[model samples]
Target: MYTRAEVYSPLQNTAIWLAAWLYSVESTDETVAALTDLGGRHSYGGQGLAALLLDARASADLSSHEPVVRLILWGPGQAAGLHAGSAAAEALGPAGAIVIKAAGGFSHVLVPRYWDDGVEWRWFEEKKRLPEPSWLSPGEADSLLSRATEQAAVLIEAAGGTRSDLPNPRLTVGTLADFYDTPGLPRGVTPRAAKVLARADRVAAIVETVTDRLGDHSYDPQLFALWRHIRTARMAGVADAVQDYRRASIS
Candidate 1:
């Protein structure tokens, strides 16, 4: 796999992820089908949840470089027991990037640059599940994304998973990136999501540079428009159009 780095955006980030998912699935041996299968697990990555799959793919970027961090209980009470994993991807504020995950009646929020800013993700009313190792269908990516976030909030409110609390949630907990990393990859044929992944890295750089230089300014709509253009071009089978994406991202 190629190296990809990114920071989440408040607007249109999901679309960016779908671009990546579309790219990855295309690269899959079966091209968009691998996302539909979890090998036999209660997975959602392969499910056709539309925006759900897109979000999951975006969340997966959170762990692309870092190892999965456990979201063990951070609060008081047995309600805090078990592995609670809610992964948060931070956007550019006046500060730096942040990633927060909460479950197990608790939460863990981390800012890559500042540990002090890191906070625990607390229980919220929701339900999220990891994509299981079962066989998957191509269309499940959207569902998996939606379900994970939904379950994450519920697990927090429910006080983690059904099992007893673990000393470290990361040990038992898994993220979208982690779930996909587990075991062997199912095989077939694929298109190519690499460009999407590549675009993520480039866009991230653009965001950083823009933020550092622009400072608290509303990003030009053209940036978003460019991103949309990239997505459309890729889906339409015009791989070279990424050059247009590169131009838009940099300037």
Candidate 2:
């Protein structure tokens, strides 16, 4: 039960909906509607979602059975098992990626790039071999979300509340809320995974909102320490959600 107002990262929405489609939990129409909403949020000029799916399908040639689609999120300290110095690693360094694994050990990684014009999907070469990402267990995911929730509360309190009066053009309280709204989970998602994702999304939204206003506050030693904790927590929560949803899809 997701509304149009809910916002999702391109990779998050794509992985969830596409996995649902792959797992036979959702129809093509449902997946298309979800992706169409995602496309409307961006300004990319590349191939449409359908065309991109077609290309990916053609490239993977997954004829044996439904493939396993996993969402791999990476950042500065987290490589998500990507080999160092590899093209896929370099491309996924900035944002996250979607890995589609077919039969016979065949797979492809789709990295979404955000440019001044819009967003584009970059596919890793099929010949390139990527390491399997280490996924978090249900207990680990729950613990991460719990810590993130606590850290977010501390951050918001240290920042003088969730309301930000800053005048930043790109990031504002309103925009952050809109950008990180609690995404809707696709059908067949496990209850634990759904709970983790919802909590993760809320924590992420709070972290972003508070981080955006950090510039306005004078550099306090305590605030800086709290900032570091919340940032780490946010990253962990996001990564956990990515892997948890994948597990949910396949389970």
Reference-based lDDT, each prediction: 0.28, 0.54
How many pairs of residues collide in each model? 63, 0
lDDT of 1 by residue, 154-249 (tens): 333233333253332333333322332333222211233333323333343343333332231244332333332222222222222222232333
TM-score of each: 0.22, 0.69
Q: Weakest 10 consecutive residues, lDDT, candidate 2? A: 1-10
TM-score of 2: 0.69
Candidate 1 ranges with C-alpha deviation above 4 Å: 1-117, 125-195, 214-219, 224-251
Best by TM-score: 2
Model 1 poorest 10 in a row by lDDT: 69-78
Task: Score residue 230 of candidate 1 by CA lDDT.
Answer: 25
Expressed as tens digits, the lDDT of each residue in 1-251 for candidate 2 is: 12111113556656767766654567877877776556443322355666766655565433433335666665334445566766777777445677776556666778877654556777775455567544455456667667756755665655654345653423454455556543455666655655555565555555555544444243233323333232333333344444444555446
